[model samples]
Target: MGTNTRRALTVAAWIVVVAIGVMLSIQRFRDAVGSDIGTDLRTFVAAAEHIRNGRSPYTEFGYVYSPLVAWLLLPFPDFDAAVGPWTAASIAALWGAVAAVTATFWRALSWWQRPVLAGVGIVTALYSALLSLDLWLGQTDTFLPLVAALAVFFASRNRQIASGVSLAFGAIIKSWPVGLGLWMFRRGVQQRGRLIAATVGTGAAFLLLALVIHGPQMFSEWIDRTLVLSEQDLVAYSVWGAGRHLFTQSAALEPLFVAPIVGTIVSWTLAAFIVALIVITLRRPGDDALSMWNIATAVVLLIPVCHLWYFVLALPLLWTWVAHALKGTRRLESLIAVAVMAVWWVIVFRLPPLDNQFGESTPQYIAVVGSSLVALTLSVVLSARRDADRAVVVREAVPA
Candidate 1:
C-alpha cells in the first residue's frame, strides 16, 4: 500500500474505533450512573457516608476498598448523586492508562509502528468490554489498574523507583497490584531488591497515612475486608472460585455437584498449576512484557477473590501483545499468536455475558476467564522461544 493509503487507513481505523466505542458505551454509561443495582459504586458511596458520619468505613460490608478510596468519595453522600462523577473519573482513568502505556512503548518504536501501537491500544481497550461491564456495574477498580500498569511497564524497562512508587499507590488503592513483584524479582535480577525496597517504603508511608486517619487498626481491618472474608466462600471470578462455582455449587451450570473434598482438591490443583507456571516463567528474566502480562493475568485469576472487574487490568496486557507481535524479530510466529488472540477476543466480546451470581462468568471475566488465558499463555510461550534464540545469538557473538 502507498503511504497515503496507509495513512488513510490509520485515520479510518481511529474514526471507526471511536464511533463503535460511542455506540457501545452509551447504555453502559447510562446503566452505571442511573442507580444500577449490583454495582460496587453503591458500596463505595455507603463507605463514604460512613466516613462522613464518623463511622468506620469498613463497617459497610462490601465496602472493602482502601480507606483512601472512601476518602475520595466523601463528597458523594449518595449513590445516585455520586455515580455520575465517579463513572466519569473511572472511565477517564481507564483510558488514561491506555494512553500512558502507548506513550511508553511508542517511544521505542519506528514511526510506522507508532500508529500501530495506538491502534492496537484502542482496539484492545474496546475489545476488553471492561468499560462496558465496569461501567454497568459501577465498578471502580479502573484507576488502580492504571497505576499497576505503569508499575509493571516501568518495572519492565528497569525503572525501579518509578515502578515502586506506582505500585505503592496501587496497593493503597486496592492491594492486588503488589503481585507484580514476580516481574520485579525474576531470578533475583539486579534492581529487584531496589524495586521491593521502594515499594515497601512508599507503601508504608502511604499506608501510614491511611492508618493515622482511619486509626491504626485500619491496616488490619483492610486486610480482613480485602482477604479474610473473601476467603470463606467461593470467589466468583477466580480459577478456584470458578471451579467451585461451576461444579461444586448449585448455581450456574452446575449439574454434577462434586463432593466438597473433590472440589477442594481440584481447585487447589488448578491454582497450584498456575503458581507453578508463574514460578517457572520467573525463573529467569525473559520477556519483561510477556512476563508482566502473564503475571498480572495470573494474579487476577489466582487471587483469593479475583473479581472479574479486575480483568480491566488486562487492557495493558492486550496492548503489549499487539505491540510485541507487530515489532518482534520473529514476525510469523508473532503474527500467528496475535491472530489467535484477536479472534478469541472478538468472540469473547460478542458473546452474551455469562450472568449467574452477578455476571461473573463472562468472557472478559479473565479472557472470558479461562480459555482466553491459554491463548495469552500461547502468545508468551511462542514469543519466549524467540527471546531464547536472540539471547543465544548474542552469547555466540560475545568474545570469550
Candidate 2:
C-alpha cells in the first residue's frame, strides 16, 4: 500500500474504533442522565456544592475522595445536568488510554497485523466487565490508567521528574497509587532522590490545599469513610475475598475451616502471599510494562474493598500482554496463550459479577483479580528468557 493510503486507513480504523466505543457506552450515558446510576458523580457534585456553600465535602454521604477532587468539580453545582457530559469525558479518557498503548507498539507490527491488534483492543474492551460496569455507573476513574502509561513510557526516557510528578498527581486524586512509590525508590540515588522529592512535594501541596478548604480533619474523615476493612465486606472482589469463600459452608464448596475466625486468618495470609509475590518478583531497573502492571495491580488488590471501577487501573497490563504477543520473540505461542487467556477471562466474567454462580462465583472473582497478575508474570519471564538468548548469540559472535 502507498503511504497516503496507509495513513488514510489508519485514520479510518481509529474513527471506527471511537464510534464503536460510543455506541457501546451510550446506554450508560442515558443511565447517568436518567439517574439510573452515577452515584459517584453525584457525590462529587454534591461535595462541590457543600464547598461552594462554605462546608466540608465530607458532609455529603458518599463523598469519600480527596477534598482537591471536590474543589476541582465545584463548577458543576447541578449534578443531574453534569452527569451526561461527565460520562462522555470518562469515555474519552478511556479511549486515550488505549491510544497510548497502540502508539507504543505501532512501529513493530506489519500493516496487516496492526489492524489485528486493533481488533484485539476491541475484544479487550468488550471483555472488561468491570470497565463496562464503570461506564454504566458514570465513574470518573477511567482516567487513572493514563498515569500508568506515563510511568511506562517516561521512566527510562530521561524524564524521571515528569514521571514522578504524574504519579504524585494520581495519588492526589485517589491515594492508593502511593504504593507505586516502591519501584520509584528503587532507581539509582540521583533518580530516586528526584522521584521521592517530586512525589512528596506534590502530595504535600495537594494536602495543603485541601487543608485550607476543610482543615486537617478532612483527610482523617476521608480515610475513615473511604477505607473499609476487608473482613467487613460480606462479598468483596479482592484476592482475600476469594480466600474467604473457601471456608464458608456453601453448596458449591465444603468449608475448609471449622470456624469463621480460622477462615479470616487464612485469608489474610493468602492476601499477604499475593502481596509478596508482586513485590518480590518485580525486577529492579524496573520501568517496563510488566513492572508497572505488577505494582499497580498490587495496589488495587490490596484495597480492603476492591470495586469494579478500580480494575480500570489494570487495563494497561492487559494491553501490554496483547502487545507482547505481537512484539515478543515467541510470537506464535505467546499470541495463542494470550488469546486463550483473554477469551477465558471474558467467559469467566460474562455474567454480572455479584450475581454469578459458577462455583459460588468465587472462581470468577478470584480469576478477575489474579489473571492479569499471572499473565504479566509469565510474559515477563518469557521476555527475560528471550533477552538472555539474544545476549548469548551476541557474546558468541564477539572475538574469542
Q: Which candidate is the best by lDDT?
A: 1
Worst 10 residues of 2 by lDDT: 279-288
- Per-model tally of clashing residue pairs: 2, 0
lDDT of 1 at 253: 38
Model 1: per-residue lDDT, tens digit, 174-219? Answer: 7677686666665535577788888889878877777788887876
- lDDT by candidate, in order shown: 0.68, 0.64
Go through the candidates in order and give the C-alpha RMSD of each one to the true structure. 3.5, 4.0
Reference-based TM-score, model 2: 0.82
- Write the residue-wise lDDT of candidate 2 on 1-400 in tens digits: 8999988887787677666766766754565566556667778888889889988888887766778677767777687677767777776666666766666667777665566566566546544565556765666677787765665556646477777787787777776777777657442334667777777888888788778757888878888877643234345456655556666664433444556777778668767766665645353322255566656766776776566567667666667667767776667756765765565356433556554222455566556656744654554455455545656777999998
> Per-prediction TM-score, please?
0.85, 0.82
Instruction: Please give the lDDT score at residue 10 for candidate 2.
Output: 79
Clashing pairs in 1: 363-368, 366-369
